[model samples]
Target: MPKNSYKIPSSLNRSFLDHEVALSGGGFQAKPLPMKVLLFWSGSILTLFWVASSTFVAQAAWWLIALVVIWWLITTAFLGQYSKTKEMKFASVPALLAYVPAAARRVLTRTSTNPSSFYSVVGIDNISATGLIKYSDGTLGQGYLVVGSASILLFEEDRKAILNRVDSFWRKVDTSCEYTFVTTKEPQRVYHQIANLERRNLALEVRDPELKELMDEQYDILNDYVGKQFASIHQYLLLKGDNLESLRRAHSVLQAEVENSSLMIKGCTMLNGDEVTDMLTVLYKGKSS
Candidate 1:
């Protein structure tokens, strides 16, 4: 029998973050405390105290000692789980409140001034572009959003890594489509060519004011949904101690809602070729040759 092999798509493979890219402009490098070392030392000290108390000082019964050990183990496990979940909650809350809103407004921008950091883009465009880049320093993963003028590109990797490569990729695409744009004097034609090369063919233009208004309404609904979902999770975590199942359920529902919102937003924002062309022209009008 043939062995089964699972392959992650190239877009999802973000091993590049492990090694420094030549073109990566420097960004901030996070210098978090060595959590593992702290945890190890704390656990060791606690274990020693527990053993000494059970064996030498208290002379506790076997049953009592066993119960103490069991309790210690359970407490340690619960604390570990709680700590992880809390970190995730903290990270997600800001994205829900700030990042999503900014992206929806289409005024979101990223500053990769740090020599060791990058950010990611999220949300969908009219071209059905939605993906995230996950960046990892072999221990932590950060996500970045990919935004484009005509068609967005999605990847499952870190934002910093994507940002590092963005210039090169944009230049390559521009080189490929420049001739078409210059010859035809049509931004749409260049957009189509670039989209074709990038394997993003779904392009829509939104000219209807009513449809745009409706999409904005739907975006409001999605924002409300996210807020409610987050609140429920927060309440559950506070009232009940770090219920993993509850967190998972909340996240699952939110993910589904976000996906639905992406589709809806894409449909509502679909821009025709002319509109896309004009937008691109305006955006790049200030660029130097």
Candidate 2:
């Protein structure tokens, strides 16, 4: 394989669909405020100020009171409609009253769990793999591997060096291997067990106290793992056409290298391709039926 061998198809060149996947070198575009929204907010603030001023003066007119009442009703209606339409949860009266204390407690207990680095998938450029990864802690040790489009790109802080390495690595890869040994047995069993558990009405079931607690704990663990695996598969599925195939190959390579201490990079986790693929297949089958 040469640096110029792998070309990104035109179909896979669209912006990422996932909110979690950030694009490299792209900044957020500032959308202009609509004229109607601006006017509504301005009128709201003016009306609120008028109501306050009238209260202070102790000469509130009946007309002024009526206007304030109308404004309040309109504001409430607008907020209610917006929340309902957007499926947003508005704070209840009790929740609003308790918000201050809840917020304070949250601040006190907040843990610093942010990742030390951020990585984004940059598609191939007709030659080698390209992507951007930034380290918050600046201890950029070994390069990170991104698996997708049946290809793997080893990326480091140094752009030029990583590009060269990607080119060199691809040349040595035996692309002819059909990767015919995809093992879905374990993943299929997990998926079937998950489906069976989901269909069961566990909430109504009676069991021994100790057994119930242990079962609940195990259920939670399995559910969490399945969710993570599904998410990983969904992210890969976002890649269109041939890109998906490339990802499959890349994932296979990375899975083998996961336990290699010298090659494993910090702040990155390689997902199991076989599990993701099997889960996806099962999901598609369920959806179709």
- Candidate 2 per-residue lDDT, tens place, 177-226, comes to 22222222222125566666655536546667886676677677667665
Question: For residues 80-168, what per-residue lDDT tens digits would candidate 1 score against the true structure?
Answer: 33242123222345556765655344532335443222123322122212211112321111111112222256443433344444333
TM-scores of the candidates are: 0.20, 0.23
- lDDT score, candidate 1: 0.36
Error of 1 at 13 (Å): 26
Model 2 residue 10 lDDT?
Answer: 42
Model 1 TM-score, 2 decimals? 0.20
Range of the 10 consecutive residues with the lowest summed lDDT in candidate 1: 232-241
**114 Cα displacement, candidate 1 (Å):** 40
CA deviation > 4 Å runs, candidate 1: 1-60, 77-289
